[model samples]
Target: MTTRTLTPETSNTFTSTIGGYTVRGRAHSLSAWFVLSLRLMMGWAFAYSGLTKLLAAEPFSAGGYLTHVAAANGNPLAGTFAWMGSTPWFVEFANVAVLWGELFIGLGLLVGAFVRLAAFFGAFMMLMFYFGNWSIEHGVINGDFAYMLVFLAVAAFGAGRILGLDTYIENYEVGGRTLVERYPALEYVLG
Candidate 1:
């Protein structure tokens, strides 16, 4: 492993091997800004999409799309999608979950609160969309897959620590110790 300080206050180092070839590098500190930008962009996209659906005159329904579109897409998960569509309760639940879930995920990311949790759900939703949309005329890689990866990257990098509320939340005092110090498990959810 190679280690080097990229900035006065921080060191970024990474190493990986693929097909017996090892690669190593250090990320510039400026990379944080790009990560922040990605968080904000994805937040806005999901927020806008959910808000539009919530404000529409007609209620959002996923039954038709799930049954007709996804089921007919010749995707690997078409049967699972069809099952979800055929189940009335699951369809109803999905309709509400998709809309509210997007809004909540967006709001969490925008404010940098519970960002890991939000990014997890965001990635899951994107995975579903990726499988559902299954337009592989070019290849299996699509925008949804890419977005899912971005969400995972955000979570893995703990992007919430960059000018986000998670910093404050993590440091909050409960009794005499900081919240994260008191409950280390929170590290999974917060930066």
Candidate 2:
């Protein structure tokens, strides 16, 4: 068997190149398109989830979802609301967070408003879901964690600025001009 290694010249930067070609950098159109696609997909996912949870539609019982999470923690809505398995107050809080978080994330992505921030919330909610389920089997495997990982790409890349609301926000004449002009995350996302 032969081994091929992919290495970066400068570890400080997120840039990567190959044989005088920019394997991941300097491609504006490509990057923007990728970000746009991700935003839409993630948005729809959240919207669907929020609608179901908020409406308690068929197959989506807020109570059932809460019970599932609680069960993972070895307790079932029989203990404390805040404690994976107790009070109704905790259940209510989680439901609200999940519902709103999803709706906002979906809407924001579609309109490209605070896209990265919305993605952040989506990721956080996904993490909660992943952890709750994992706890059920004591670190056992679950697929939901993979879905949560999708946001990692969005947040780390911060692609919304590419043909996104950031294009305008980046140039806004606000108190802080440095952040707008620099476009820090551009390097990683662009590459």
Candidate 3:
């Protein structure tokens, strides 16, 4: 049998078989799959929740939720939601905003579009949900906290560029300055 020596170029890659399928490529880090899973799961959750609220059989209103929050004695944000519920115009605005926000966040993550922006908003929204009358009796922390961290991670890693539209947008330059150059701070937050 003859053996071949791998050069530097060839050394960069390796092959492995799993479930009888041969996979050949550069090594994949755990973070790659972790981000992908987070994106899909978070995206699906927000999209499904938003769609349900939007297409509910009965007319959906934020007033009821806000009103309930207003009555939640142990919830720190009860007063805030209560005040919001007290204002008809603000209530209407919030109702539309929350539903649309969820839908947009989901779409952004799923399609890997404007992921940084989406994740920023998603983090804050999750924070609001967590503090917005969630019963302390249930637990001090909950799923929203976990989701918030995932959103932050996505933003920090610019995870969208992996398999999303951000990959295309990342290379676009305007007036001799790439988008990242113009918004250097965004480099860490977006691709």
Candidate 4:
């Protein structure tokens, strides 16, 4: 996949507020809209996936997979999937893993509640998606993965001043230092 560079910070799109920030401070423009758009898109994407999976578990489940499906598609993960098939129960677990992850990602982004946590999980989930497509020659991937990552980074920076709960969540004694805040790339979620 081609790499895309982030635009340098400019304009008032990305803004922030201080003093437990209930929209109490100023922020940037492009950055703020970027966050808003990211949150909305990420939420919808996962909501669509989660809803589909909820509607049909069979196709996504291992047993429903055609034998050598990945190999048929020329993906190297075929071997990994074969190995995983050894545990009869694993497919169910995998399905559950993706379902819950997408569900929460959708919920968090849509509601703007615990958005950082949601973005963290959303980014992590996309990493898994990235790995999934890595084995193919000239592989294809979701066009939105990078956008999701940016949304995550913005949440890392906290966009609650305009429409997020992160604003109020940043001030508690433990709030700024919470686990989500301490994650190396995610501290801004608490800021």
Judged by TM-score, which candidate is best?
A: 1
lDDT of every predicted structure (CA atoms): 0.89, 0.62, 0.80, 0.62
lDDT of model 3 at residue 140? 77
Question: Which digits, one per residue and each the tens of the lDDT, describe model 1 over residues 1-191?
Answer: 37655664446766779999999877787889988988888888988889999999999998987887776778999998999999999999999999999998898889999999999999999999999899998888999999999999889788889889999999999999999989999988885
Q: Weakest 10 consecutive residues, lDDT, candidate 2?
A: 76-85
lDDT winner among the candidates?
1
For candidate 1, the per-residue lDDT at 190 reads 81
- Model 3 lowest lDDT segment of ten: 182-191
Candidate 1, residue 13: Cα displacement in angstroms equals 2.7
lDDT of 4 by residue, 53-140 (tens): 8788465664344234444556557677555555667776776777777877776677666777777777877765554444434446
Candidate 3 wrong stretches, greater than 4 Å: 1-28, 183-189
TM-score for predicted model 3 compared with the true structure: 0.77
Please provide the root mean square deviation of candidate 4 (C-alpha atoms, Å). Answer: 10.2
Model 2 agreement with the true structure over 100-186: per-residue lDDT tens digits: 878878777666667667777777877776655545463444555666777767766665765567556655665556444466664
Which pairs of residues have clashing backbones in candidate 2? Answer: 24-191, 79-86, 80-86, 80-87, 81-86, 81-87
Output the TM-score of candidate 1: 0.89
